[model samples]
Target: MAEEELKIEEGGKKGKLMIIIIAAVVIIAGGAAAFFFLGGSDDDMADVQAVEGQAGAAPSASTGSAKSGTALYVAMPRPFVLNVPGAGRDRLVEIKVQLMVRGSDSEELAKSHIPLIEGTLLQVFSSSNADDLVTEAGKIALREQSLRDVQAKMQEIAGADVVEEVLFTGFVMQ
Candidate 1:
């Protein structure tokens, strides 16, 4: 009977030791995981700072301001009305366009040269075919062409690409 008691005590001690070791391993693994997830390395912080600095310093053509990182849109004073020729008869197309500019200087330049820009845009619009304007691809191509034309003219006057995109605010074909 004493021998049986001794064997039970020894088994109990072994089981307790195994439980303690497993608990210790789990606690250590949890601590390591928390440290890695919560404490991001110094390199990550440096990369974030570098990106913020570049955003402020670089001249962004898409955004209005390097400091604010916002887009600036300038609306044309008047809508453009052009006669688009068709196979049977000519159709009148009216469009309202807004220019997306980057900086204050570009905005001012665009405002000042509105007349010249309007004339250039009108020339491009009037040359389009009425049939082509009915298609989605044709409209997209027209918008692209307008952007190129406006940017070219702005570049000539401002010595840089002032306009980023030409957006059609309104389009009517009659």
Candidate 2:
């Protein structure tokens, strides 16, 4: 009878150990899943950069002169960092934005509004979160908003149609 009790005790102990191991594995797996599915971190930045192509390669647009003017090339710097709650504190990133401005000379228009454009972009990007800058659709919306902001700022600063289209040269989430 003592031997039998010992056997049963051993079995019970083994069973408990097995349950503990299974529970540990499940917890580990659950943490991994949460880490992957939750998204928004340094890892997500890779996905963002991959989707965006080379920086500062904006296509030239025709600048209808008072008579006939040629288009010009312009390169603008995007916001540096976008702070978001999901990616730990504030995450820092560097971006370059390409733009095609239509005017007597695209270069001149782009140049004149560079400061205003930069400031507006910095303001907009500073306020944005990772969610706001995620996905192609989100980027498109951001571009449209940027165009409006730049054009409005140009009208205020240079009193002209300084920007035509806002293009993303470098877009990253992290």
Candidate 3:
């Protein structure tokens, strides 16, 4: 009877060991599957490397003739919030902006001058009336004005168009 009990205990241990091994195998397989599905593709890596190469070269200026490495976006650190005069009453306005650049150099340049850019955007946004902001055409005109002003400022500082677009990712007026 003792021998029979010992054999039973050994069998239970073996079953547990088998379960652990199977669990390990399943976990490893899941990890490999995720890696394959989520890893960056070769094309993405090549584009990143190309941009890095251009930035590392330290080009004197990003001229129109130079190839734009990649489209990159730089987000302003904070949203612009201010009050604008309306037809009836003053309303609070908030705008979140992102700058799109053609290459790494432009990205860096824009990042370095974020304060200036923010100020420029604030000036443009504050100049608008709340009533006009209610219309789609007014928003488009504001965006165009912002882009032109930012580009002009960048050109003054860097002698190149560092920002390609001024995107209003978020806008609210109340």
Candidate that beats the other on lDDT, 1 or 2, i.e. the better one: 1
Per-candidate TM-scores read 0.63, 0.52, 0.65
Please name the candidate that would achieve the greatest TM-score relative to the true structure: 3
Ten-residue region with minimum lDDT total, candidate 1: 61-70
Q: List the residue pairs that clash in candidate 3.
A: none
> After superposition on all CA atoms, what RMSD does each candidate show versus the true structure?
9.7, 15.6, 4.6
Q: Put down candidate 3 lDDT per residue, 1-174, tens digits, no spaces.
A: 999999999999999999999999999999999999999899999998887786653333546322356677999999999999998999999999999887667788889999999988988998998998999999999999999998888889888878888999999989
- Tell me the tens digit of each residue's lDDT in model 2 across 29-80: 9999998888679867877565433332233233222212333447874445
- lDDT score for candidate 2 against the true structure: 0.66
lDDT of 1: 0.82
RMSD of 2: 15.6
Report the poorest 10 consecutive residues by lDDT, candidate 2. Answer: 59-68
Q: Score each candidate by Cα lDDT.
A: 0.82, 0.66, 0.86
lDDT of 1 by residue, 111-133 (tens): 88899899989989988999989
